[model samples]
Target: EPEVTQTPSHQVTQMGQEVILRCVPISNHLYFYWYRQILGQKVEFLVSFYNNEISEKSEIFDDQFSVERPDGSNFTLKIRSTKLEDSAMYFCAGKNGQRSTDTQYFGPGTRLTVL
Candidate 1:
């Protein structure tokens, strides 16, 4: 079975530092997304990407954040400047392009700790 994969499983950064998190989704998936769960909070969608452009985004994906599919296999999220409030577990998810009702498969998540 295919699954989503993320790198740098954990990261710690200073308040003003930039951070980039990476992920690789199941090969046949066509939709990709980023979601975050602030410590003790529910998971919230940040953005969605398809056809190599952003398809949808939430209020949380402000100017400080960006997403990219640098290549055929990798998707990434970058924070221009980290904030203590940004500390959370960031998840990368995807769903197969062939199935409109397919459940999204989520990566294990990258834990970001901003100080």
Candidate 2:
């Protein structure tokens, strides 16, 4: 079965540098999303994209953040300026266009740690 994959399972970065988290969503899926989980918080949706444009986005997706499908198989999230509060598990997910009951398959996640 195809699955979402993320790179650099764990990353430690400075408080003001930039970081790019990579993901390869399941092939054939049409909806992709990015979510984040703070150490003890529930998963929070950051953004969702389809047809090469953003479908929906939450307040968490601010000016410092951006996402793109750089190629047919790769989707990437870039953070222009990291902050200490940015430490969290960044999850990449995909849905098979089943809107009625879409189940998102999530990657293991890239733990971003800013200090």
- Among these predictions, the greatest TM-score belongs to 2
Which runs in model 1 stand beyond 4 Å of their true positions? 98-100
Question: Model 1: which residue pairs collide?
Answer: none
Clashes of 1: 0
Query: Per-residue CA lDDT of candidate 2, range 1-115, in tens?
Result: 7879999899999998999999999998889999999999999999999988888999989999999997878999999999999999999999887576989899999999999
Tens digit per residue, CA lDDT, model 1, 28-87: 888999999998899999999998999999998999999999888999999999999999
Q: How well does candidate 2 score on lDDT at residue 32?
A: 94
lDDT score at residue 49, model 1, on the 0-100 scale: 93
* Model 2 residue 26 CA deviation in Å: 0.6
After superposing all C-alphas onto the true structure, candidate 1 shows an RMSD in angstroms of 1.2
